[model samples]
Every structure is written in structure tokens, then in C-alpha cells.
Target: MRARHGGPAFRRLILEDPACGFDARDARVTHNNPNEEHGRLLEACAAGDHGALQTLYRLEGARLLGVVQRIVQDRALAEDIIHDAFVNIWTKAHTFDAERGSGKTWIFSVARHLALNHVRRQYREVTVDDTTAEQLDAERSLTASAEIEDTFDWQGRGDLDRCLKALEPERRNCLFHAYVDGYSHSEIAERLDRPLGTVKAWIKRSLQSLRECLS
Candidate 1:
């Protein structure tokens, strides 16, 4: 399957109910060598073993969901990404090479990439007028400040990564925290411990720089 976007149906069709005989709690500490076992399970999945896929899900589903949910911040959307990630994992299992990387890492990367793509798509699609942006800023400024990240793993598009790298690290981080991780200006300011206005300025200038470089 081409990693069906439809959630529950695709899961049932390809994965059945993965919870049939496996307890997620048991999968956690059952193996002496998780990396090796994960590799074997992925190999089985490549050879058409649906049960192996289920085992993999039982083992890693919670963690994958956690990783994705942190990025997208929506329970429903995070669940959707997990479903799609598994579909891609199943279809692409044959392409996995254990020598190059661990199966666990590979699986997480699939989910993370999907989540990041969703966030970026949403950011690109949202067009806020200056008034709307200011309104959002005002609202955020009033709310109690919460902790957030100063930076994240940067995944830029094509030459965009080079452009991002050329900018100051703090500026690059401001952009990533805003666009990639979907943090608000207030949140970014709290995380970076800079003034909210400073965070906003960095983001605006960084975006302009990126556009100029890309254009």
C-alpha cells in the first residue's frame, strides 16, 4: 500500500488489530538486544510477515506516537501520522539495510519526517494578516509563559539547509522553533529567554533571508 492517509481502515486492512495477542508493556523489556531483534522483525516484515509488523507496533507504537505528538501537538493528527508511518514502513521494509542504521532509528525517522512535513504544510498554508498576527501576539503575551525549546533538529528543503546554516545559529533556531516545531512567538521567546519582540524580529528577518537565498 502507498501509505494510506485514511487512518483506521488502512490500519485494519494492513495491520489487523495489532493488539490481538501482544501486550505493549511486555514488549518493552522482553528482549536482551532490542536493536538486533528490531532488525530481525523488520526483515520478517519485508518477507510478508504481518505478525512481525504487529510486534514492531507493539514495541514502538507508543514512543513513535509520543515523538509525533510533540511535533504536531494534536492527538488525532499524531495518531494519523503513526498509521501512515506504519503503512510506509510495511511497504518500504524491503529497502531497509541494518548495516547502515538501526531499525528502531529508521522507524522513528519515518514518523518524524511525516510529522514535520505536516507541520510545514500547515504553516505554509496559513496566511495571517498583520492585524491577525498582532492579535495573536497580544493574546500570547497575556498568557502565562510556558517552557519551550530553543532549537531542534533542522531539516530544510534542498538548498534551504545551506541558507539556514549561513544565518546565525540563534536566528536559524528561531525559524525552526517557529515553523518546524510550530512554536508561537511567545513560546519561542520564553524558550530562548529573549524578549517576545526580539523573537518575532528574528523570525521575520530569517524568513526574508531564506526567501532571498532561495529566490
Candidate 2:
């Protein structure tokens, strides 16, 4: 789903570089536990409170840009994707179900998906052979739910990056295609020229191995 264009003020609030204004560290100074506030604030946004949406931008805009930039690897394009992401978050806030995942996860998922969509459209043929995949911490928020949702405390596990690197390139490619690129099992199978069942099993086993390594 694409985000509709927002007004000028909202556009400036999001599209401007984080270095020029918003900083995650500054947001944390006043809000010690920002994630905890996301659900309530998102509900407020759903109720048509622009201020609540701004608060969310202040809390997550920079980090969300980081997530997008890492994937798209373009500063200006990442900012554009982040702008679209927040617009989607504002417009789609009402659809969020707290039961499905945390509000932070929902918003990040919105941004992440937009970035992935951009990558797929621009770089669909690029293969992830021996290239080290982007860190899975980029997807930590989405991993907590069964299909995709888990914590991203990479610092807690010193070897998390090593563990990811240890996985076979094809297997790691499958995980990134599924999680980072937001591709479905069937789509991944078709893209990678593997059977659907094999793609599904590889994702499952790869996830289990990562969890075990982290444990």
C-alpha cells in the first residue's frame, strides 16, 4: 500500500534530514520508554489527533530512516520512503490491531515494507549470493509475531552477526528475502528457483537456528 501525500508542514516534519532537526537520542532524553507509548499514541492518531502523529514522528522518525537507508542505500530516496512510511502510518493508523503486534512494530513494518518495495522495483534481479546480508537487527521489531516478530537485542548476543554470517548464503538469502525484502514463501521460491516447500522449510530451519544461536 502506498502513502498519500501529506500537507507541507507534515512533509517538512518528515522529509527533512534527521541531522537538521530530530535525533533519536534527543527523543530518548525526555521519553525513557518510547516504545511503551506507541500503542496509546497510535490510537490517538487513529482518533484524528495530528499532535499524536507528530509525537510518533519525533520518537521514531530518525530510527525509521536508518532502517530504510540501510536497505535502499540512498540518503534522499530513503528519506522519501520514510516520508511515505509516516504518511501511511498516519493514514492507516486505524487499521492497526494491538493484538497483532506492538505499535512500534506496526509503524516500523510500514516503513520497512515501503523500502523493500522500492528495492524490489529497482533491483529485483540482484542476487544475494556470497554477499553478507544486512543485519537481522534491521528486522528485530517484526520478528516478535509468529509469522514475523522478535526482539532485536543484538548487543545482548555478541555473536549474533557471526551466527547470521555462519548460515549458508542460499539459506541466508531466503531469510532476507522473506523478512527483509518482505517476500512471501511462494514468491521467494519462484525467485530463487527452489520448490515452495523447500523455501518454507529453509526459512523455518534458518529461524530456528538463529534462535538457538542467540539462546
Weakest 10 consecutive residues of candidate 1 by summed lDDT: 1-10
The alpha-carbon deviation from the true structure for residue 135 of candidate 2, after best TM-score superposition, in angstroms, is 29
Candidate 1 ranges with C-alpha deviation above 4 Å: 1-30, 125-215
Could you give candidate 2's per-residue lDDT for residues 1-215 as a string of tens digits? 22223346544665344467543442322465566689878898899987778888887888998888766666767888887898899899999988887899899999998877776774444444211332322253234233322222233434567788667677777876666545666577677656555666678889999998888
After superposing candidate 2 on the true structure, give the runs of residues whose Cα lies further than 4 Å from its correct spot: 1-33, 126-204, 208-215
TM-score of each: 0.53, 0.54
lDDT (0-100) at residue 153 of candidate 1?
Answer: 69
Worst 10 residues of 2 by lDDT: 129-138
